[model samples]
Target: MARNREKEDVESRFNPPVSISMADSSISLLKLISILIIFVVGVVIGLVSSSHIDRYFTFQGDEFNFKNTYFDTEQFSHDGQKMVVNCDGEDCLSMESFVRLRNLNHRLRDDELFWRASFVPQKEELPFRRVPRVAFMFLTRGPLPMLPLWERFFSGQDVEKYSIYVHALPGFDLEVSNSSVFYRRQIPIAACRMGSVSLVDAEKRLLANALLDFSNERFVLLSESCIPVHDFPTVYKYLIESIHSFVDSYDDPTRYGRGRYSRRMKPDIKLADWRKGSQWFEMHRALAVKIVADTKYYTLFKKYCKPSCYPDEHYIPTYIRKFHGALNANRSITYVDWSQMGPHPATFTAGNITEGFLESLRNNGTRCSYNSGKTSICYLFARKFDPSALEPLLNITAQVMGF
Candidate 1:
């Protein structure tokens, strides 16, 4: 009996004993199961993340739908330069043609065929943010009645980190008094007609005028009439750093953007050169400079991006499509309510500007769950607000800025 017990005790000893291999096998099995479970969890997380990345970061051309409706009659320049333009925008001269302009003309007029550097930032200068500075380019024909609201938003600390450029109408004669933050900041501007070449010219002029001194990394165009739906800092970061711009559109040809300015552009004057949209837009600085200083396309656009044709709606997006198609965030940030088809956007009446409406506008047709805040889309500013609607907006400025 004693000899049998001794043998069993000896067999049960795992350390350097007969059962060592069995213990090792059990340990290996547990490790294998743990590894399998961890891998499955990792794959699930990766799949979900990838889906979100694909949805938001990926570019979709749906928002860039503007097209040329018509072109001008064959015409000549003041120097007897005959320009026979095609009305069908499909005839647009390739953007490659402009490459020759920067090389040849040295200024789009040079053989190299390109405009002077307008929005390009210096490589050495540190960006205003670790990302970029947002240039709030305000296009307005009236006083900034909401200056009090704007003043509170800026709040003074590190103000130099950002830039503000106002394009006020030559007629408005906006005073640049010390009392006015806008004082001395006004760039030469013109009144915009509903559908006119003057509007395109004005946009270009604003680009040119803004480029003369300020060289921000990003350019955000806003109307004087528009108001911030969120805090300035929050909106500022969004406009300057976010890769996607807020101009909205679906893929439907009927509903897509109307940018059609390629053929109407001068040397090739085809009916094809027409595009259209709201006068307001936000863009990277490189694009801003490209539009403002363009020589070849500008000449063509001047000829075809006409007042009678409503150039404001066409020029910018069309040029962007042709010249720097990839760089545009493919969106506009300013909000204009044109729910009803009409020449004018729906203006916000005091009655129409309820808290619910303001909430909706601030949401910018996007939800802001914790998971989506990084990509949460919203409009920075909204336009056509009745002077009376200003009161309601002020009441909720605090909440709007947070999300």
Candidate 2:
């Protein structure tokens, strides 16, 4: 009996109680189950997060696709109800929001993308009445010293008949009073150098911005020095009633003309197709859309047309002549004196602002056809006027220019 009790004690020391062992087993099983549950939840969360990230980042090529999705408006606000969400330093918004919010205040920075996106055709006619307004686009270096004259010209005119757009250098602002016609008229501009494609780019930028307003039926390219030769009524009646766009396109066999043509502009633009014209132009809406939407010819000129080959002087003329020749009047409405025979046109001064000189400009002995009828009123505007001419112009604007 003593030996048996000793063996049992040894066995008890070696092994624990059955009840305690069963309790430990239960705890171990519980721990395993908890660990498995935690791992499964972690995997599920990771998968969902990855899917959301992919959807947010990827932009599929489809109309009204993920590219148009906007952030929650409650969290982000800009320009009233719309908000421009910045994703990796890019503006992203839905088509609905973009159309509602897009205006002159918003800048279209990317040239290639803007051109491509804006090239879309309006298949359906406008749903509302479009009052045709002339868009006077000014491509200038900086300040408009002649703003007072323009203000006077635009003053008292029906506001619905005209719209003004100024394209000055980037970071340069136009100083005009709240009551002035040029107030808040500046558009987003790019840096432009003389005798470069960038000048053409600036012009196109102006056209694109003006094209934003569906009511703009005519586009006139102007400079800081350009002034109205005729009254506002005469100019408006001439342009608004015209059948053809006034683009100064003519063939010149001289070195300045055909010599500027490059053999590289072959197949697409032949020597016969090449023409020259004034940089200043007044074009109809149809032609304006064509020039803004063009990429094939623009690329050619940007690459081949260089210093001597001024794209500003040749690109529009040649392009219009080749494609839309019938639509153009083949003349510039802005008169410039090239008789001096230099790299630049003659710059008129305050002394040149005389009534006789203005009369000659209005009727320059060039009986050009206006709406298929002969009219002495060939030039509607004149350029290269010195800033000093502003006072004299304002002095005689009422009596001589008739407005």
Candidate 3:
């Protein structure tokens, strides 16, 4: 019996008997309370963790396209609206009622849909119609302050097809008139401070918003100070009828040319690797989507890109180089004198703008044509013009610039 008792004691010490008996209520109740406390604590912890996780991925007010095009979730409240704008098919009744449509991920599988796209296109290839209208997007700080000169250039019989979008600084109450050429047409705008990446942001906002309502096919980003070197029809024919568009990555082995991609855009899509030229570029609607929807590279740009390095000059060209370099003719259409460096291009003075200079500008160099219709790579516009230089440009527009 003693031997049996000793073995029982050893077993009990090694593996204590669970006192989960109703008769032993005190210990059992204590254990039940402890278990309940533990469960409650776990529940609280789980709830907090769940909330934190949900908030992590919650969508902010800022939107992204389903397929990186202009189709935003919030732009249209109702369904069945037609796509009034596109690169291919002429402005006609769209089969899909834009309001009823919800798919943000629509991508074309056909080629030739974008005339010259590197990626997916629509199945039903649309033919090139009578020269497509080009939208000249003038990104400015507003008032135009020089609208009268631009008015003379834009107000002609052949200018009916083309449209203009003005992106101005947010605060200024733009001096607009009912009789002014800019009546009733203010583009969706974001604010910008000079010599900042916010300029790129403003440009993107302008493009994306215009993509919603405008029918103009080709997009040219012009500044408030820009002036037409040629007429609207000539510029239109130059781009549409040309074999390729002018979008380039100005790579200089001796120096960095692309200013859009900042030093911060590295490891994922570095400035050096994804380099592009200047802020002034002519882009197709298709390329615009790739730019705004570029999370892979753009996110990196947002993190590392800063004010000092001038990412605006480099990002666009670098991205185009990586994704759509081939679509471009690899040259910029807007004329700029880059020989003088720093914050901006050389501002043209009135004395500098002469009839001879106008001729030189109108026939400065040959442009590459994708249209197969026009001969020269027509420089649609030139920029960094001083307000005073406006007089000379206007004086010679009839002779040199078709407008």
Highest TM-score against the true fold, candidate: 2
Off by over 4 Å in 3: 1-131, 158-160, 253-266, 270-272, 341-343, 365-378
Order of the predicted models by TM-score, top scorer first: 2, 3, 1
Q: How close is candidate 2 to the true structure, as a TM-score?
A: 0.76
Tens digits of per-residue lDDT for model 2 on 35-134?
9999999999999999988776663434234444444434456556665554432254444333322345664575753464365446667555567889
On lDDT, the candidate that comes out on top is 2
Q: On a 0 to 100 scale, what is the lDDT of residue 237 in model 2? A: 90
Displacement of the residue 312 alpha carbon in candidate 2, Å: 0.8
Q: Stretches of candidate 1 above 4 Å error?
A: 1-132, 176-179, 189-194, 213-215, 244-275, 364-374
Write the residue-wise lDDT of candidate 3 on 267-333 in tens digits: 6665457554768888876677677556566555556666654667766777787778777777777
Arrange candidates by lDDT, descending: 2, 3, 1
Residue 163 C-alpha lDDT in model 3 = 63
Cα lDDT of model 1 by residue, 246-309, tens digit: 4322222332333433443545443343344566787766667667666666566566555555
**lDDT score for residue 36 of model 2:** 100
Off by over 4 Å in 2: 1-103, 116-125
